[model samples]
Target: MAGKRCLKGVDIMKLRFLGACREVGRSALLLDDNVMLDYGIKMGEPPEYPVNGVRPEVVLLSHCHIDHSGLLPNLMDIEPEVFMTPPTADLANLLLKDSLKIAESTGVNAPYDAGDLHTFMYKTKTVDYRIKFQTHGYNVEFYDAGHIPGAACTHVTSKSGESLLYTGDINTSDTRLVSGAVEFPNADYLAIESTYFSKEHIPRKETEETFIESLKSTLDIGGNVIIPAFAIGRTQELLMLLDAYGIRPYVDGMGKEAYEIMMKHPSYLRNPTHLKRAFDNAISVKSSRRDDVPLESSVIVTTSGMLNGGPSMYYLNKLYDDPKSKMMLTGYQVEGTNGRMAMDTGIIENNGVLQQLRLKLEQYDFSAHAGDKELKAIVKDFCDRGTKAVFTMHGDNTEGFATWIEEEIGVQAYAPVIGEKFDLH
Candidate 1:
């Protein structure tokens, strides 16, 4: 809680990293001991949450992804006012409810219950991008981050005039769903995600074409194509991509509900009309009709993305022994997840029994986060705006990314560890 004095003798702002420092998951940061950003949980055998104990006056979420917003229900006892975009609130509620069901089925105790969810939702206050508001002594604004339907970058200014910007998950390159993140007012302190700092994404068009070709190849051989995608963002993006390529896909799982949610907020999307068309072109899979899905020469899109649980497992189980069938992964497979194991070892455990996969497995880079080159461009833009200090987080190699940022951008950069604190002047 120590602060440094600024040039005008005003106390500088303080930052504490609660989670998502050296690795990607459970992103949380405490600002000035009163306001918090992104209380989340890492997905694994036993989920991991952000450090607890200190209760903030308010919590500001950057997005609704599980890694960024999963643990919000845990804070319901404190009843802190939560702020996020309207879409984020809705999406987060969906994800949290699903998490509770998953935990119940697996015989694990969820940190919070239905009552907590109700309380969390009751205290939530939705805000649109660029609208300035007051929370405690800080002036806060949200900026579109272009990572998902309602993802945002949070910018805050202390009463003393010091400013800090937290770039939640960001994508600087435009996708079929939304435009890339736009430039915003610069700040003295910047916290950026480095999820793909050391990697470069393939050209978007090239990746799309390749994926479509693979899908067509599988279907041509009378093999079913199973695409396991995240329910929210990736699912919609894949639907649009398939539609644009003139392919009809069967949509299943929570993605169908998520799509309906997105349709409600047309302003947050790049092309609402196009999305609508994509939705119309895709066949929505109904639970009653799931048994009727064509077993061959068809494409199916389902969720849980990681193969942990969901309709994807049902589809995978049916296609496991079909050598001609293809399983396409459309997002990052975090370490220790069922998806990663399937990708790396071609083995999946079901009902405590190990099953070998004989289907063709492939992964495509349809990630929503920006890649290394795009991230560098973002850093360069902020540096040009006189950002003095940068804190890197939400990646596997934050330390490496921080070093590169400091040496290449000529600005002080650090990859903080969990529970570390810093005084910004």
Candidate 2:
């Protein structure tokens, strides 16, 4: 449904929410019917995607995370002109290729193929942050999102003069790898992520101390530690943290390649020296060397944070029967994932067989998203600048966040459902 004009002679800008409404994955949004923002997918046993058959004239990506930019390869058939930062382009390519390999190994038909990935790369154009450009009669710009390397918050001005901002997986808190997101130009319509709304993150220093202490305790007891992290942002950040705390970990999976890519682009990181130190201190694990990983008094950091695939599973299979060993999950585990199931119950399924885990399991909150206070600050910052409308998304509690924004922040806020459309003027 469209909103009525509150002012005379103002043009209407229609928005359609294709995904990431009250959920935290598959984020797709269409503006003015021609431009699309962030077409991604939800990772699970049976992966889910954004609404199909969207043939936008142009696509603006926010980051490389699967939940924000996973479905871009599928759009090769449409041949949409895609724009992202250079780092994002590199990371997305790495991740999509891995995704295709995983799909093939699992006997699942992927939506796109190697040819599609090549086409997607061919149509991609890299842009730097804060630089405005014209695309299909719209003025477009990107701001640093601070969630991951080259993540961005997108702003667009329609041909008819309406303005909109779409924040994709934002993190307004400084991390070891990246700085916090800062102010952007105000717009009439705002779409922001609410990943951590109603929750506050522990202070970074304290969290680091706790994590280090836990690792030390496990090592002291002659137990090996396994840290499952996302291949992109979280793995790199954890490596820095481990280096800072004087711990050397065995790095495995796509995270190893991801760090190599990150090293090539020092401009995208907060401190290249720290990242370099981490890489220097860590031991890189080759796939053929998996069986040689020391079973005692060692720390292993691997990818597939949700434990759905990757080398994390290989390590877990080897260590699951060791009572003294411990597994530390370093990221959010979506429901129905092996990681989540293991956390809730000491059981994990392998090859269609469920088995009880003897090793200890722990979870730490090392999310890259902004917390409640940060989300509120972002909303109030834009609200004070005369943002007329707000839409909360990319979380389970989107409706609650929208209500809070409307009632507490004193702005017109909405929690749109999937496939919902609105006309903003």
Candidate 3:
């Protein structure tokens, strides 16, 4: 095969990194020369590029999250058909539509407008999770990534003989709403996400207990807690966790919005009945109007997790003036986001960046991505020979992930560069 002119005559799968190669956000990968698995996240991005012209044969969304699905709107004239699992489709619809409105009202233009969003939404073909289906030249299937509801680690095989797996923000732990990522058996190249590779996260149970107890203590002190969460995965899990309190606490309007998204799922929830019963008994739906101070009576879960823009910001605006109100941070707050602003100033840290900031804040790391040990166990089955190459992406905490994988597995792991292309057999 090596001696012959196979590369020119025969179809060979080549991977070109579109985004998410070294840093977090903007994840796009060109698979098999034409099929675009994801069209999102171009870091420190330019307004134009050459690969932008490559008409995508198909755009597969791993989940409805903004980072993975963000590029769909930016495509030029190519109206590539978009495909996602049913739950992802539902969540994407809501998220994109909401994102569209934000961009419009803020006078911030994005790739696609609301009309294009619906255009793609109407054309979206929703595949059921775990089922093998055919699209274009690829036979594809999905396994729950446990990162978000309907999120998946996609497996695709091209007709010309290339098979691969892409972990789209995977979580190895079993959580309230979804199952862990499925094991991969074969691939010429496995594109893995390394968002948390640098450091190990605290145990899930310990984090959850701390988050809840903090809220309970705040509530007991006659304080209201506002937890800004990504509407899809984090909100669902938090609802289930909060319901563990037997007294049946109140959920603000933001929680109601996420609950509507949950209702769109195909099957029964991955959460227990206690949460469902709590949803029935507790939970308050907030109004579109601001200025309602929800004090001492509720827990509000809203999104635009970083608090860049969303209903959560309005909620915060409503509560910022109230002394009895507290904000609980359940996930990572990016450097420049409002959540980070509130958190840094609230704590009496003498650090210059946060010294002048203001507000009462508390946080816990409850991210859904897999930690070190869990990631090792997930890839344990692939210890056998015959694997070709391993490339890691979507990690900022490059902390020691690359070295760890290389030393432990005896495989040469390389973190590729964004926008760089690689030749795969």
Candidate 4:
């Protein structure tokens, strides 16, 4: 690890890249060695955690996704005062508890136990969007990030008058679930995610139209359609879409719980009434209905979006050999996940064995992250407001994205690697 450096006459603070450098998960960053932003873990066979051993006085969380909040419980020993939105706290509790359950059932030693979860919850403080507060002598505020319910972008101003904005996981595109991220706060420095720097999604209306057309075609042929989606935001969006088109899907898995949690905090949603109507009209699949859902020509929306381990696997096991059935994926499939495997080789691990799937597979771009154009617009907007430096992270093409920002946007940019520290004066 490199040591922090300072110029003799300049007031300087250090920003350390603890994780999420040119990668998608395990996000962590340390500011001034005493304040942390998003300590999380990557999900895979054994899972990966953020760099360990640095203690912070406070943590500013951006969202509730596992990649942004998974490893938070591990900080219980330090007992950092954590701040997040009310809905994020509830959703994080749901996800963290499920992670612990999955670990116990698989016999994998979890990084933190129930005791750690309790401590994490005890140290958590909820704050609303646009609300300004003080922590460790620095002024802080939250902006709605438009990724999921309670997701936020954190802006912090040091006592010395330097300002920094950390966008945890942002979406500048509006979906049925939430609106685009709010206008960014003007700051001297910006740390933003580059998740979709190399990709641009098809327009939302056109994508939905195509999705509905395909669904109708599959259902018209008497084939059961399985839509695998992430429980948090994607599932809810699909529900509203399907409801609008008069298709009632059989809802399953953790999405039910996630929906219930989001409903408790309607202020974070774009249209809570529409979501509630969709939920009411949808059929909730119980344990007894699992074996029968695939028997009929039905539309099923289930979780473990990557087709990893969830109710999705059970449906896959029953329909993998059926040529008439279909499985539509609605999220980004990280490398090494079952979704990627299915997309690449038409094979997936089912019931502890490799199986070739005969069911037709398709992927739709329902991502909550901003696309290449939106990213450029965000950078330009920040630059127009006098942002002098940009630190890009959380994507495979972070280095290239940084280069583009420097060359095209005329700003100083860096894609810091894990464990690297930079001085901001």
The Cα error of candidate 4 at residue 10, in Å, is 5.8
Indicate the worst ten consecutive residues by lDDT in candidate 2: 1-10
Alpha-carbon runs more than 4 Å astray in model 1: 1-10
Residue-level lDDT of model 3, residues 126-224, one tens digit each, is 887778888886888887777877888888888877777888888877777666765555765577888777568888789877877777876777767
Expressed as tens digits, the lDDT of each residue in 351-411 for candidate 2 is: 6778789998989989899999999999999999988889999998999999999899899
TM-score of 4: 0.97
Better by TM-score, candidate 2 or 1: 2
The lowest-lDDT stretch of 10 consecutive residues in candidate 3 is 1-10
TM-score between model 2 and native: 0.97
Summed over model 4, clashes come to: 0
Distance (Å) between predicted and true CA of 203, model 2?
0.7
Candidate 4 pairs with clashing backbones: none
TM-score of 3: 0.86
lDDT of 4 by residue, 144-215 (tens): 998998999999987777888999989888999999996788988889999999798899999999999998
Which residues of candidate 4, in runs, are more than 4 Å off?
A: 1-10
| Alpha-carbon lDDT, every model | 0.90, 0.89, 0.68, 0.90
Lowest summed lDDT over 10 consecutive residues: which window, candidate 4? 2-11
- Backbone Cα, N, C clashes tallied per candidate: 0, 0, 4, 0
Query: Distance from true position, residue 349, model 4, in Å?
Result: 0.8
